[model samples]
Target chain A: MADMIQIEHLKKCFGDLCAVNDLSFRVKEGELFAFLGVNGAGKSTTINIICGQLKKDGGNVKICETDLDKEPDLIKRSLGVVFQGSVLDKDLTVKDNLESRAALYGIHGTKFKERLSELARLLDFEDLLRRPVGKLSGGQKRRIDIARALLHKPKILILDEPTTGLDPQTRTLLWGVVEKLRKQENLTVFLTTHYMEEAADADFVIILDHGKIAAEGTPLTLKNTYTGDFITLYGVSEDDIKKLGKPYERIRDAFRVSVPDTHAATELIIKNPDMFRDYEITKGKMDDVFLAVTGKSIGITGGEQ
Target chain B: MNELFALTKRNTKLYFKDKGMFFSSLITPVILLVLYSTFLKKVYDDSFRSALLAAGADISDSVLNGCVGGQLVSSLLAVSCVTVAFCSNLLMIKDKTSGAIHDLTITPVRFGVLGFSYYLSTLFSTLIVSFCAALVSLLYLAVVGWYLTAADVALLILDVFLLTMFGTALSSCINFFLTTDGQASAVGTIVSAGYGFICGAYMPISNFGNGLKNVLSFLPGTYGTSLLRNHFLRGTFAEMKNQGFPNEVVEAIRESVDCNLEFFGTKVEIGAMYLIICASILLLIGIYITMNIIAGKKRK
Candidate 1:
């Protein structure tokens, strides 16, 4: 696929502190791209620069084959951004909030009505249209915010920690909307999230630490490079576990052994059938990949600990 | 242009929908008018009637009282226009804090267009409130047998429009410096409290000492009050002119009630006053636009 967004040597600083430094990345068309990082890792800074909300100190950014610095308004028109903050006015009703944003985009009259109704149907908030935004639940508000951003039918959607405060069920439903939009419109999604599971499903994932790219690859590839396979055995005694010269955990009568690959993990469990009454093998997780790359857990800094 | 209009419409809808905002822009002014008519009317009538009688112009009680009421009503018009327009700047601050300004900036709407739309919205809302206040005063004037011709009403509208434009522009320029809640509240309180005094709405400018009056000459409300008073009391002043009163006495009463603003010991002619109001609005817009552009360049 063609690249939808391209950044070259992007750098931003605030006084003595560098917010984004010597970073570069490309988001392909119709790709579900994930930007993963701890707090202050420059995900939002980079997003702001691309969205034309903040000026960059140094960099060249091209969105949809147009230079961002030269034609920022043109580029902004093609990009829809839903930042963590709820930009919708709480005092205005759901429909009024959307209508206000629509007016800014120059979508009014029958066209605004049409687009609003379509979004209402898609987000399943038709009944909540007349209700004030402040009265809505967090999940409902998030959905409305997304609907507001997408009203202009932007080709690339930027979501910054969109599902942070959402419930698990709402998160699933929101992602379902994203998936449907992607398949139907071939939308390019650039998402920043702390949820490793959410990043795990992206077509491309990039991890940032201290304003630089620490890891960049597909979820499966990163997992393979950074994570280890594991085997768990039930009804295994300490003496029987000690027979193996590998690290093992004793939980009641069960033992878990870590290995390099699935073959090695399964081979160990098969070789110890008499020691294990029952056994299971499992693959590594995405957070393991994140830990390997950033050397810190999500949202936890070295100084914080 | 269409985008600006749409944004203006949106703000209008929001302003009208909010009951609290309606009261601030409309009801408060009407209530002030009622208080002015009932409580302040007698005091002003007694003082001004005695002053006119002392000026050697034998005037009927009702006509002399009309002059006082007209002056007070016009001064109220100017002060309320400025106060309500300042209140309208709250919408811009709300947009900023709510992050909707960022939301709009990310679209094709430039800051100039957005700012212009906000000003237009403020202008429209101020006019609505000012109109209500004018109606209350005009209705009272009618009860006292002091009626306005249609041309006089037209002149009154023109005066209100210019006053509102000046008020909106001045408020927009000053509000650029307000960011925090403390700053906004402080500015709001100061404008609400000081505008009336400075504009001679609470007390006639003739009562001010030379030093204080000289300082007030720079405030827009002073000129705005003078302009509005001239239009609103045009008929009453004309009647004074036709009653065979000497030109000196008519001018004296006009000066006493702030129907004419003074500059360097000279009365500002109506044409010059209009020019000053228009010129001030233009200068403020120039400053506001240039300020935004510099701020934009700094960001870029």
Candidate 2:
């Protein structure tokens, strides 16, 4: 895949504090790329710089092979960014807001109408086009925001914490729509989200810590590299597990033993079939991988599926 | 250019759509008119009568009414055009507070086009409301006594247009420093209340002490009010001349109503006043554009 977004030594600073420090990454075309970080970890700053909303101190950024410094307006045409905060005018209806935003992109007449209708249908916000943006619920507004972002038919969609405060059902529905759009449009989705499970579905993930790339890999690869799989025995005593010469911890009523991988877990279970009759094996979660890499808990447990 | 017009149209629509903003811009002038009629009318009448008595000439009530009405209309317009601008230009601050500007800046639209769209919208909205106020003033003038010629009415419109341009440019410059709704409102309130006094709209500049008059002379808005006063009261001045009143008395009426504002000890000519207002508008617009450019460079 061609590199849709290329960042080399991207740096941004505010006074004495460095917001994005020597950050470098690339997102491939038609890839679901996740950028994960805790608060003040430079996620928003990086996204803003890429969207040409902020100036970087030093960097070479290319979007779809267009130099950011030389042709920022040209680069902007390829990017559809959904900011963390609401940008719609409260007094304007959803249709007016979208139409005005579309005008900024030079989308007009039948092209605007067709694009708006397509996004409305795709994002399940067709009914909300005439309602005032301020009157809509959060989920409804989120759908409208997504529709506005897609109105220009941009190739790269940058979602900055797009589902931060949404309900579970709404988040699931939003992700489903995003997945569908990704498939249909061949979109290179650059996402920053707090939900580990959302990042888990990405083709590649980058974990940022204190303005640095702490870790980067596929979801499964990061999990296997940073975290260990677990095997829980319902009736095994701690001493019996100690006798097995494996590290073990006591759960509510089970002995949980950790292993390097699913292969090790299955091997141990098969070797002690009598002791592991009532046992369940689980793979490491993205949450665990995140915790291991950043050494800080995200506090929302995404259990194994 | 099409994008610019689209955004400008949307912005103008947004201004009128907000009930508080739209009504406030219109009501401010009406309120000023009412206050002037209720309290200031007698002050102006008494001053005119005394001027006539001292001159040993008795002007007819019809011509006296025309003169007083001209002062009323000129002061109302001079103040309202500016205050209405402060209200209409709130759309810029609204965009900033709502983060709508963020969405706009990220688009492919150039900053120059975006900025010009905002300026055009402010100019159009302010002009619409100010013209409506001008109509009301004209109606009031018709009711009191119609002394203005077709040329006078035409010149009054030209004055309104020039004042609106100055007000829009001044408001845009001030609003560049404002970001929040509270700040914008506070500034709006201050301008709406304090501007009339500063421009000598609420009272004659001749009534103010010489020290203050000298200070007011430096502001272009002072000249703006003088320009409007010249057009609005020219018909009455000519009437006084026809009624066999002396030039010094006509000049006294001019001085009393701020038609002949003195810069330092030298009296400013009517043509020079227009030049000053035009220059101030250009200066204000230049300042606003420079601020945007500096801010844009900082962002880059």
Candidate 3:
């Protein structure tokens, strides 16, 4: 796949503090690439720089091989951005907002009408067009924002935590819309999300931590490299589980012994049948991989116990 | 360009929909006109009128005519000043609080376009408010048998246009200076009030001492009121050349008056220039700030 976006040694600093430090990444064409990070991680900032809402301190950003600094208009023309907030005008009806955005990209007349109709169908915005945007629910507003961003028919769509604050049902609906767009338009999607499950759907994930990429690879590869397969150990009390240090892994309330294969699990179970009777073994999930790489567990309530 | 226009139109509609703002902008002038007319009738009694007449004052014609014109000009200036100070600040704050500015920044639209669109909307709002106020005052004057020529009406409209432009420019500049919405509105109110008092929007500059008159005369509103007074009351642009003062003081008044016109014209020019310079500067600053925040995000 061709490189849709290329970033080289990008850096941004505020006074004495560095916000994005020496960051480099490439988003391939026709790929749903996930940028994963915790809250306050620079995901939105990166999107801002890419969309020309913000500027980098030192770096070269290229869209389809056109340098952003040299040709921001050309680059922006081919890029669509859905910010964390719903950017729709509250006073205007949804249709007006969409029409205005379409006109911004110089889309009009028959071409605009066609795109509007197509977006309305795809995003389920048909019934909501005449209504004032301020009256819409949060989910509907987000959908309108997505529609507005895509009206220009951008080559690359940048969604900055697009599903944040949404209910699970809405998130699922949005995901379906995104997936459909990817398939129908061959669009390259650059999405930022803290939700591991959402990241799982991406072809590649870049886990960001503290202004740097902590790990980057296909989700499966990163999991395999950073974590281990399962080896269940029974007859271990809570205290015993805590004492079983080095190689033994405790994910949530379950204790697992890392094993190279099923044979190792079976041998361990046979050695302590009574202890293993109540235990079940499974492959390492993305949560375990996240814990192993960051030395922290997914959904851990507080500091380490 | 089309997008900007669409945005402007939407904002203009919003301005009209705001009942409190609409009333203050359009109705406040008429209310002031009524109040001032009643007050003048009581103060300018027969004794004072005869005294002024004995002193070579044209009490029979110019006093009544000028007083009518004065009240109209004062009410219009007050309305425009208040409307610009409050409405423009509110709009800017709304954009910031609602994330509209962030949304605009990310779009392919340039910052210059966004700022220009905002100014255009403000200009439109001022014109509407000013016209409504002038129409009301004209009706009141006609009922009282104070007639005006076509030239007077034309000049009055022109002066209102200049005032609207001045107000729009000041509002844009205020938005640029203030960051938060609350702070912007608060500061705008204080500044507007101070300027209104200093420019003698409610009183004649002639009532002030020499030192104060010198200072107040430099205000754009002062020149605007003088030009307006000359047109609506005296019915000639040349009437503005001399403000009924002694020869030595007349030069000082002219100098200060000239400064205000030059300053008002400069504001219009700056407003146009700000479409480029202010937008670019703010955009750059916003980018720099956001970039660092993003960098911080990468660390976590």
What is the per-residue lDDT of model 2 for residues B79-105, given as tens digits with 9 covering 90 to 100? 998999998898878888888898988
In model 1, where do residues sit more than 4 Å from their true spots? A250-253, A260-273, A299-305, B27-31, B56-58, B145-147, B209-215, B241-244, B293-300
lDDT of 3 by residue, A1-305 (tens): 89999999888877777777888999998899988666545666677788776768988889988898877778878888888778777877898777767777778779888999998898888999899899999999989989988888889988887887788888888989888889988899998865677777789888776668888999888866786567666557756544434267666756777765556667766765656656776666766666676676534221221
Tens-digit per-residue lDDT, A23-111, candidate 2: 99999999999998888888889988998889999989999998999888898899998888778888889999999889989898898
What is the clash count for each candidate, in the order shown? Answer: 0, 0, 13
Candidate achieving higher DockQ, 1 or 2? 2
DockQ for every model, please. 0.54, 0.74, 0.30
What TM-score does model 3 score on chain A?
0.84
Better of 2 and 3 by lDDT: 2
Question: How well does candidate 2 reproduce the true complex, by DockQ?
Answer: 0.74
TM (chain A) per model: 0.93, 0.93, 0.84
Q: How well does candidate 2 match the true structure in TM-score terms?
A: 0.94
> What TM-score does prediction 3 earn?
0.80
Candidate 3 C-alpha lDDT tens digits along B122-162: 77887777777777666665665354688778867766676
- Model 3: lDDT of residue A94: 90
